[model samples]
Target: MADILTVNGGSPLVGDLEVRGAKNLVSKAMVAALLAEGPCRLRNVPEISDVKIVSGLLELHGVKIDSTDRDGELLLDPTNVEQAHVADIDAHAGSSRVPVLLCGPLLHRLGEAFIPDLGGCRIGERPINYHLDVLRQFGADVQKRPEGLRLTAPDGLKGTRIQLPYPSVGATEQVLLTAVRAQGVTELRNAAVEPEILDLIAVLQKMGAIISVETDRVIKIEGVDRLGGYDHRAIPDRIEAGSWACAALATRGDVYVRGAQQLAMMPFLNVFRKIGGDFDVDDEGIRFWHAGGTLNSLVLETDVHPGFMTDWQQPLVVALTQTTGLSIVHETVYENRLGFTEALGEMGAVVQLYRECLGGSPCRFGRANFRHSAVISGPTPLRGAEITVPDLRGGFSYLIAALAAEGQSKVHGIELIYRGYERFSEKLDALGADYQVG
Candidate 1:
């Protein structure tokens, strides 16, 4: 039976909370550990579903992984990794993009690798064509099989200059992982410069990989003969931090988010400021509060990295419903992301979907049948209703909507939130939220 969370709305969340390692970076970093010899120690890891899936995959490949630590640290010993279990690998490949990331590292460690289907937020058609194309360019023999993708590097990996059609995060990570052990230097243009990617690069550098980052979206990696074990702490989760900030605004409460960095969330901080959500940053974490004032409407667009992130758009959209004026949002990352807006509209939010590109260039969402542009008419009274979580960030949006609504709300598929959030139900309870798991 699927677990559900029943929330009684009209309660404000208060008190302090701490965020751990990023869900985005930690998973790929686990896969990166497979590329190096000996044991690697990772600290401040978040206890999320995706991380568990990665740990399981590493153990299936004969890597020794221990999750019994109190602080969510993992020690991965990859020296004994022999055969990659296809059944175990294939089961989770379609659940997250991290499995696809393992393809490069596995091929580097053991000449052949099979990657099952890839999965993540159901926002768009995340095709691995760009990743496979880059892998083929690097001299890896790739073939599509009925079960999954089979890749072999007979002559080992040879580096080549690669330019991405779009700055896809997964594809960029794939190139970085594959090219690190390839022959000669690999230059990647139009690379994703997300903070999580930067953190992964930092971990790789600690493992004795020579890599440099340039301003023009160029990444250069020199092929290294062998990589040593690395011990590093991951960066704080910006997405979780942003979600809490939005939750604070939606409920008009004060919350101090510990372990959250301000620099990583500058774009979201700017938007929160415009929306009348007051926040202050210190060395430890960020503090969010909503003073007694009118919430304002601001235009938003979701881009890759350094731009407003696609994941932050959903939860913030729920907070936008409390704004006094009309709010315009353009989603550039995923096509089916607007499905959550329909759920919000059910709770009395005046959100209209548009087919035409209201934000200039053609977006993936607009290109598809799913509406990318949303006009939110707000200060509307929201009433709670039963909702199902479609994806990760969308699940948080439902939680935000439930928190802001007038009555009781039943949120099904609460497990989806566990894919990224760590002890989310417990955290909500700590914040004085009226929610119970059923």
Candidate 2:
């Protein structure tokens, strides 16, 4: 299949659609199944490439997976879990970071694990240093190997207190997955409490792990004698919901997004209203649309959970280009995330990249000289042009920009978009988009 899309722009996307489980949480929940002896059933899992990657990795490790008659559901049994060949694991885990997180559960099951170098989106440098450090504190012996990294726990893992320099979502997940089954109690400071992370905690709790979250970014996990399985429903994807909302705003369209919850999206929803986009919330989902007036521009800064999500910034930046005034976006999460704005500039958007922290307060990138900030000035009519998808969120941003533009755009590298988005082309067709798959 060709990874290309030719989109004829200028019309708005107006329709109803549904988003499945959070891709960020679903994959981690699938990984959580490895820690269970009984079969764990996960519902509302999105059909995305990342799920396939994690499932393949689990299958290579001898987890028996069977599907139900219902759509988007899986029963994963880790009863006969065994070590997978490093080469096989590497081949299955291409472009995914879940393999590293598997080390703890694999060690608990098999006493040793071999993990290949991780690969993920080109958003920023997401180091596994914190993961390795936390694993070591839990008594796993980490060694560099030719294939990748080998972790062994001969004396068995015992929990220990750990501190994180930054409240990273990945590192926090690593801690939770490893600390759940270790020997004693573990305390972690500066842990991430994102909605996805909290949902992951709920899944682990269902699997018989005792964990508590404190308000001051602290988490305590007490190791249990045994572990069972869980029947869980994953949280709705706020990132995908916000992306669709931005798509509607960018194209001056109306979209009813099913499964978009209000609580998790409160920060994003506030920003949406501030930018002059209107949304109505109900029990099922959210209805987002343009408000028939000039859209306002404002300052936005991305931070950890309870703040504007870093994932929401890219597509909204595209929407901001249709706003009335200047919109300043300070990307404090990933240093090079603003690099994708170049394509919008090519499409006649006035996006200026800057090295300084331009939104509210200075971040770590202020001294690193990375172009981590953007200023978008608009109400400028966009003209579609040839573009290549940069990464997952950035790829969706390209689609929004193309739909909001005048001419046609040939979007290359669209296969990367499937890594996170589930049946995106079908949804585009459902929303009456003028696009063709090549």
Candidate 3:
């Protein structure tokens, strides 16, 4: 039998919830431990499936990891690290994009790496050409195979200059991980400087890696010969915080997200205020709610960093369904991110997808046939409908829609949500949401 979530709607979700470390950073940080010469301690780690996936992958390579779920602490030791069988990697990785990240650290440690066919949320075409190209620039040989890809550093990986077509977070991470312990200094142009990326840099620096960020998407890494372990408490998950903030607006409730930092969330907060959603920022957290009076709509665009994030677009789109006017969201990050709107449409949201960029400057995908833009018309009454969870962020958006709808919603494939969200059902329960799982 398939697992499902049944949500009874029309009630506001109001309560206090704590957000742990960022899903984006924590997994990469776990991968970073492989580069350490000794054990690394990571704190505030969220209990998400991605963490489990990375932990499993690390163990397969002979890294010893100990964790305490209650305290969210992880101790990863790389002293006995060794290569595992290719079949084992394929089995453990299973549809996760993390194996691609294992490439750099594995090459540095074992002088070789193997990556299986990668899979992630089918939200867009996330080609790893950028990653592979960066590895090749670092003097790693790439070979394609029936299973996936194999990489070897015959010349003992040397650093080189690289320029990314776009500031992709994953690709930038690839460069950082590979270049940190290389033979020479490396310069990366057009690199992503997201908060999560900065946090990962902090982790690397704590491990004795020398890295610097210059203006206009430039990052420099001075290769180090020997590195030690790091102790770090990851940055709070701003994406989770923003998702709950949108949930509050959609359900006309109030939610206080503990551990939510104001700096990382400033862009989202400014947009939330523009939409007539109210928020107060304090040291501990941020409190978000739907302000009385009709909600307003505005044009928004998703950009690399210091702009509205692509992950933030979905939940806010659910809130836009309750706004008084039309809202245009131009998603420049991932091409197919707007596809989740089809379910929103089924739930009575009038959202239309557009192939051309809508209300913002044309992006890289503008010439392509991808439907990367969305027009949402609001104040429409949502009715519960059976929905399938697509990806992590999209799944949570579906939950928000269900909570704001007039009746019950049956959500299947919700296990996909566990890859990022930590104890989501428990959080929903704490918020007084009517939901059941089986």
The residue ranges of model 2 lying beyond 4 angstroms of the native Cα positions read none
Please give the TM-score that candidate 2 achieves against the real structure: 0.99
Q: Mind sharing the TM-score for model 3?
A: 0.99
Give per-residue CA lDDT, model 2, range 1-438, as digits (tens).
Answer: 579999999998999999999999999999999999899999999989998899999999999988757689999999999999888998977779999889888888889988887888889888899889888988999889888999999899999998999998989999999889999999999999999999999999999999999879999999986789999999998999999999999999999999999999999999999999999999999999999889999999999988898999999999999999888999999998989999999999999999988867537788898999899998889998999999999999999999999989999999888988999998998889999999
- State residue 281's C-alpha deviation in candidate 1, in Å: 0.9
lDDT to native, each model: 0.88, 0.92, 0.93
Candidate 1: residue 199 lDDT (0-100): 96
lDDT of 1 by residue, 181-243 (tens): 898999999999999999999999999899999988999999998998899899999999999
Q: In candidate 2, what residue range of length 10 has the lowest lDDT sum?
A: 356-365
Per-model TM-score on C-alpha atoms: 0.97, 0.99, 0.99
**Residue 371's lDDT in candidate 3:** 94
Question: What is the clash count for each candidate, in the order shown?
Answer: 0, 0, 0
- The 10 consecutive residues of candidate 3 with the worst lDDT sum are 356-365
